[model samples]
Target: MKKFLRKNRMFLSMCAIVFLLLCTVRTMYKFSIRDYHVKTNKVLGYSPLERAMQVANYLTNLEMQKLQKEQERIDFKYCGGPCRFINVLYIREQETRAQLHVRHLAFTSAKVNRTLVLPNVSGSHLGACKSHDFEYYYDMEWTRQNKEYFNSIRMKDFVAWIRERKEANVPVSDQVLSTFDLDTHVDPSAVTHCFSGLTKPKSTFNQILKWNITGQTCELSIQAREIAMVQFLKGPSLGNGMNANEDIEVLHMEIYKANQWSQMAQSDIPIPYHPAVIKLADTTAKSLGPFVAIHWRMEASKNTNNMLPCAQHLISLLKRKKKFNFFLLTDYPHMFTQEQQEAAMKGVSSTSELSQWLQSNSDSFLMTDFTREHHEAIHYLYQHDTFHVLETEMERGGTPPDHWQIMQIPDRLKLADVDRPRMIDSGWLGILDKLIAMRSVHFFAGQKGDVCGRSKSTFTAQIIDARTIMRKSRTNYFGPKNKTL
Candidate 1:
């Protein structure tokens, strides 16, 4: 073998060189796949509905990716100038989603540290959604929780803040915000088309690379780089990852920090109940001991006389065991506009039938009675809200409303002033109603959309109704109907 090697040394050296070259090529290929998740890539569509659903997950995954990249390149610091902050002002469009978006975006910012700032969202886009109320569940819960964050700056103040930073030689992100939509046209009807398997947005990191839309895009060249902020602003669900990455660990840590900073105290953002609401709840709890809290969704569907059946079932279930007070929190679809009610109920029984049944049901408490009782709460909330608004204004270096200005603010709120927090009173009232319902002993909820009802019932005052037991003891559920094994 030695003689043969000596004879073919030239051939052997050539073979070794080829082998090394092949190994290098293979390593490069593996890394390229690692840096860009090719398998997870897909086409993204331009639909508002898809946009809303995907935004949360997109932001979440983007933060995870960016955090990972930042850590990987931690020691590889660039000698670039002072990094900039691109404040992504929280805008309350459809306020429910808007609040969620704010929270999600904040979480992303915390993890990625691209220095994204969220401006306080002002104004509820009332009557904006096709399938919901004028001022659907926009509440003070988010703003109150993030009071410190919102108080940080205003629109003009933020602009000035960025300007000052720029002057002081601090890099401020020029590309503060970007929309995901490749094309601007949002055909409301096209959302349905996208879902019909006909179209889907191009959903890939490479696609984002193609578009070059992100905070880094403000600073870095739009070659072939992954910008975490851009990934968040756009993209569908982050393709499911198999192995948990270090980015996830950082994300969890950031989330913990964020929660610690923003979780509101019960007293700080109290359920906007009038003194009478507390009085009513206290009086009722004292007299009735413990009751059942059930939220009926009759307002969602006209044929949802399901509430009547559920109520009767509740009564039948509890009547024999104990005299249970039923705190029923429900929406009157009939109260909505004709289009809204129709959409909610989809040609169910007229409001009169449901109203008549509710009126006749001696066991039921009327929503109107609840409203009359909580009028003081509604009134008090306005004063509380106006006070906060003034405080915010004052914080922004603006004049606070004078005592007379506050006093002159009429007890009666109007549609004209709906732009402000006055319209939010209804949302506050709705939350109060839900909380009251949850204070019940045993809850009876409609079987359909069981998740919604079950979620509410979990807060019951054994508090564990069938639903709660199912949620907590459901693993024991399949085992036996027996409690004690």
Candidate 2:
């Protein structure tokens, strides 16, 4: 054995060293892997067990929250017993009328302790009617937070509640909605039943709460039904009808009065323009420094003859204020007007009279002056189509004649086929105009008189009221005197 050991000693020593080296390498590798995993776990702040526990806790909380929401929905729908709801019909004209209608109804609902079903604004045109969610135009979060001021639900939610109730075999009141069209010669006797025969008393409330159109005293009485709908068609009478003198605990309600219906509508609620609108308006207004806003409603002026004269007068008034830039908002198609077209044919500068006047007089801006990005933002919002046909039908008192045909068409195709005019020509563009005008240093709108040749416009009224609420200057350049300017 000693002889064999001596013969292979060198080889034996080499094998031992190699074996030790191999073992050391293996040990280092194992240590590195263990250290890496330990560090990773430390960074994550949790072991496998802790992670599993966290996941389980998250799932449990999610399920609990969902259950809580469902319970709340059930509570709201059932209302602890027989459910009572007051659904207001949408005023299918423009944003101003629709907004005012909802505001008045909200006040009435809060006063009578009924859940107000708010109508979604219609984005329909001459060809097709498309319903948009209330949040599309206004801040719904404000309404949710201001439940103390008024308890209201979206028209869609109300429709869903009604459907669920019907499916559950719960009895719903089929009482016909009391609708009044004040545009026609509505007898006081016909609408007096709505007030339960309450006469317009010689009270301070009566003096403040006069109807906008008829100049009659505004009054209302709560209906005695589980489900009641009151629709005031045409004008701001519905909004003016609310008892502004009612002793409400809401702090902002103090500013509410009959004449200042717009202020009341937005009082504590501050239902500002939609976030997208504000974003767009802010972008545009940032570029336009210290500009005056002019809203010229030439399309439907009470006195069409006054429109041209009014425009000339407005030009003169703006000329006097030479230092300020001008932002003109008009329904008139300046590019497509007869005068512009004729000028284009005659090899003259293809500009409308108003456009030429504005260009020659002051640095003027229009919706067309918006940048590509600004226009793109507007288009993006315009593409946000919401289908609330079921809700709309319910709110409108009955389904349309072509309901079945409309239902047959797919929602996407329906939206695509809808004849949505250009943003400049569309009624919805007025929303953007209003937002921009509200931010202006000065606002001038057409008024009802021979001097202005403009009709009484709710659009102008709303903008002025918004300016008032914003504590901006109320200086307007409407009349011939331009005294405010």
Candidate 3:
């Protein structure tokens, strides 16, 4: 053999190499076949429903290429229950499968005789579970019939009934409850006592009491009032009868308005504390930029309950941004508690006060005097050093105003005529339109005064000059035809 190998060493070596390569290729092909096994790849050709079951682990074993059935044999070794059964239902809708059975489902409201309705099962649906004896008992005809006692029935049937009732607009009440079988005559006290004994106190009375007293007190007090307000202000819930888009649009408008007001508060320039400097700045601020001063006044009836709600609304809208320094010039500072007032001013950048100056008979005899104070604020804003009113009267009058926008006049109204901190003019509407069109700023205040107080001199003075500003204006700035107005 040694002599033969020496004679044909190259030929023998070549033969050995070819044999090793063939063996390696064969081994690799076999391994590749095992790696790409059907169990690993899953059925790419199955229907969507078939694929879903496979993915969900419902299919246990493939009996044939076409007939794959779910593995329903739950391992009973875990529980000592008497028996088990696998109940399968074929559902046509994707929704039914997603919401599993046995979750919201109740088996029976009562045992043998007395039946009662289980209302808790109304909106909730069933969930899937695996068990031993429970499954066998659940499969029994007697057990299925007894489920009516608990209002726990087949989820598919229950869903179908619910759908019918929904289409009929039948209310969920005793009538609806009657559809389910419940043992009304069952003595609940014995069972209830048994369950009660098993239950433990969740927490100490003191802990729960503390939370109820403190945590929920604010919400409880205010939530009831808010609900009442919604009833009073917004009317009724029209439900599905109302156009959803229209409702959303109106809500959006309110949200936008609120946000804009909040933004205005942020942009508002505040007066410096120094008297001379404050005075100088107030006059110059408005002049430097073409901005308007908004003098807004909120009034509640004397000894009225309106103060809290009104203040809450105002504070909610005002706190969004520190756009403007709100000189909350008010008459009844006493109406709100100090804490409430402080809360309102928490994020407020600055506060300036022009006293309400209520005279001895300000309510009636000196009503005019109270009005003067409001007008003075407008004048203060127009020429004040802190606010810069950029637009000249001629220019302002000529320009069309948006719906809620306004501009002010300087040094025209007397101190006695200032009624509110701010005033709105006829030109305000047009001004608001302009602001909306330009999206220049969220809001601008032209003048702040009582609209009802027509003959009132302070407002009249500003309105008179504003009318002249309107007259000299190239556009019909104050008229209905004005685009901004």
lDDT winner: 2
Whole-structure CA lDDT of model 2: 0.46
Residue lDDT tens for model 2, 235-267: 123366653322221100111112223223344
lDDT tens string, model 3, 97-151? 1122211112211211111211111111112211111221112243344443332
TM-score list, all predictions: 0.33, 0.50, 0.17
Which runs of model 2 end up more than 4 angstroms from their true locations?
1-81, 124-130, 169-171, 178-215, 218-270, 334-427, 447-455, 469-471, 478-485
Error of 1 at 441 (Å): 2.2
Deviation from truth (RMSD, Å), model 1: 24.1
Sort the predicted structures by TM-score, highest score first. Answer: 2, 1, 3
> Could you give me the TM-score of model 2 versus the true structure?
0.50
Instruction: Please provide, for model 1 over 155-231, each residue's C-alpha lDDT reduced to its tens digit, 9 standing for 90 to 100.
Output: 34434444444344332223212233323332222122101121122221111212222243344532222244334
**Which regions of candidate 3 are displaced past 4 Å?**
1-8, 11-15, 35-266, 269-485
Worst 10 residues of 3 by lDDT: 249-258
Model 1 residue 266 CA deviation (Å) reads 17
Global lDDT scores for all candidate models: 0.34, 0.46, 0.26
Q: Give candidate 3's error at residue 321 in angstroms.
A: 42
- What local lDDT score does residue 376 receive in model 2, on the 0 to 100 scale? 25
